[model samples]
Target: MQPTKTNIFLYLVAILVNLLSFSIGVSITWITSVIPKVDGSTITDDNPFGRLLTASEISWIAGFLPLGAAIGPLAVGKISDKIGRKKSLLILGCVNILSLVITVFAKQTVLFYISRFLAGVVLGSSYSVIPVFMAEISENHNRGALGCSVGIFVAIGMNFALVAGPYLSISVYSLLCISPLLIFVPGFFILSPETPWYLAARNDEKRLTKSLLKLRNKTVEEIHLEMTSILEVVVENETAAKAGVRDLCTNNTLRKSLLICLVIICLQQCGGIAAVLIYMPKIFEAAKTNLAPEICAIIVGVFQVFGTIVSSVVVDRLGRRILLLVSSVFTCLTLVTLGLYFRLNLSDVVWLSWLPLFSLVVYIFTFNVGLGPVPWVVMSELFPSNFTSIAAALTSSTCFMNTFIVTVTFPYLSTFLGMANCFFLFTVVTICGAIFIYMVLPETKGKSLQEIQKLLGSCG
Candidate 1:
């Protein structure tokens, strides 16, 4: 067998990184479904909070983790820049354990909110740190797959949480979802190693050597040569300051990257992804169905896994821009159709008993194809290393805000605008998303991060 750049140890570490992301996915996804158990259901509109409150409160609960997770990529990116990705991951592991301890015992909405908020912080961190870890460890040919593995694992974590969460009763059973932490905590600790890029960033040769030995134990010469190439790339791309908001804004290239980040993320949430993912049951009711919404939830979650798997497989081969464009076109059609279907109240036709379910399934498939995996892939590819994490944070923050607005607004929107209008509104927004992506979004596949930055840089 040909020797591989990724050693068993680094592969294991990458797996740990994926596991952390997955656990976060499960923790975040599962608990979100449980929030209404305390907060109340939107369909009935009779929570401890008012119906509007049920919307507002659930929005707060649902948005917190992503909001909190938004902070992570920036924090871990910086920490990884300074300490190392492995150490950063380990610290997050500790934070995960601590946050869960608090969440598991949380009594009130406030405490629960804090737990979700803090957990989001950790989630964001994992997103930032793990890719850097993977990119640093793998050879160029393998990096894309390795980077994408994070998505697969993320789906795995989310799906596991989805299947398990609804099956178990809420409250304590909900709390038990934290168990991924136990598996991840020890698994990341003993099994995961520090990212070599991190070691090189800090100029920790000894530790870098150790990381090299762990990932590629074949020869010190091979390790040294590999480290040199990576460092040269890093040095060649080195900039004057860290990836501050100012630098991101003032520089035309960085600004475009930021815009891409913002637009794509906005596109992602505006697709009404949260409605289906967060409230599968509510969406089914919109479809006027007798089917189990929970089953649909699991189904949607599974689509994410499979869609991401497909994207990971074909992203390099088919190219990023085409996939995005195709994804957007399909989504536009689905959203409009879904909107009109509800608008026409076509759910009750004898032959179309499963219309809502079908719409949802198709929507899920299209979403997973277009918005689910593409945004993150784009974000990671857009920024240079220095700006990568904080850029991720900024991107994540904007995305989550859009997400927050949509989630908080959906219930009220459906009531005020009417359900048909709501879906139609989503359709309109998605159509616009397709246009913006075509016009403004840059193609990044098959280019190094630095090359992308150069291509995006202003000529004048």
Candidate 2:
């Protein structure tokens, strides 16, 4: 990799671009705090409607975001392809700002529903486009590290929402959530350059040279060689047949890449992180822990951010497959242990009141380091350039769809099966994920985009 000092501009761009992720993280967990306040319970002092929202209505409120997100990637993928990543993101930021403004003024559930669904559209679009943008701008050696930074910003946003949501009124919290996009929209537009790949694909040599000058620290000779390589890939894509869902399924290399992406994304969501995060405060309340539910959620969120920091530092060093395997195994163990703790609670094991907090801290930390972030990095690396945008959309939409199912069903599942049983079920799913990772995933660490495609192409 280039020396750390030379990559400062690149890192800055990564940080600015990922502020979109920060907003997404806040949207995911904001409902947890808001639900109690609006449920017409003792907490009705903060209720906007001064009336009870039925459990079904509340579930829809929480579900709408992911539901909208599940639909966003399909449309946004095409938008990014047609308009380019930078412009697509700018549009998303404007839309996000508008949605949050609506949210601040919303007194009716319908308005909240509309605002959240719009936010989800932004969420899905960001996930679809951000990885491609990051991958295109990054150097081969640092791509994993930079791509994994998505989880860091997301964790920070989730932590911010958890810590701030309880203290602020709904309007105040909603307005505060708008701050990231306000910063991101202007900052990214002014400071960040378009990816060299996008410019090269359009044969815009003048702009492509300028973008590379901003993004690369290499000498002119090296930049020329890199530009040649990019142009070659663009030519190859230009000559290749158009790819679609049907084409993706029939092509061997693309099919394997897509299957890998789908499996990891499904595993990522099915491991129950989304449900855990969305219901964290409720989980603590249900566990009857000594610490306040909000406090426990905040603590776990802090650990989550820490874990992503660790992942960013070590990802390129430790490699992707190993971290994923270790994360999956340990995450499985934590969930199984957590399930056991809840099950044994029937016997009055108040002595282990701290177990849930300890278990969750480790769970969140482990999840972030590997399963949380590495899958996104791997997804970005696995696909060919021609297929990147559409493949990313398919993967992201599937991811959010799984998230929607898990988040919407968690309450009902916990009520019917008990939290212990629910966790046990998650443990089983995680174990299967671990096996899949070991048996199927190829190591992509330190590989170039071309090299990764070759590796996937060679896979039987």
Q: Please name the candidate that would achieve the greatest lDDT relative to the true structure.
A: 2
Tens-digit lDDT track of model 2 for 1-460: 5455449889889989989889888888888778767764554657887788887888888888898889999999988888899999999889989988997888899998898899888888888899899999998888988898998998898899999998888999999999999999999999988899888878999999888887876666768999999999877866875758887899888888899899989999999998898888788877788998889989999999999999989999999999999999889989998899878883256887888898999999999989998998998998777788999999999999998898889889999999999999999899988888999999998998988878887885
Off by over 4 Å in 1: 1-7, 35-56, 70-77, 239-242, 458-460
TM-score per candidate: 0.88, 0.97
Model 1 Cα lDDT, one tens digit per residue, 1-460: 6645445666777676776777777765765456545544343322222233345666677777777765556556556666656667777877877776775555556775787787888776776566656766765555666777777877777777778765555445545766666777788778666766666656677887887788776678767787786576566556455668898898778888888878877887887877656766677766766666677777777777887788778777776677778877777777777777777778767677677677676777767665777677777777766677667767766666566677667778888887777777777788887788888877767776657767787421
> Scored by CA lDDT, what does every candidate get?
0.70, 0.88
Question: Lowest summed lDDT over 10 consecutive residues: which window, candidate 2?
Answer: 36-45
Clashing pairs in 1: 68-120, 68-121, 69-120, 69-124, 72-124, 72-125, 73-124
Instruction: Report the number of clashing residue pairs per model.
Output: 7, 0
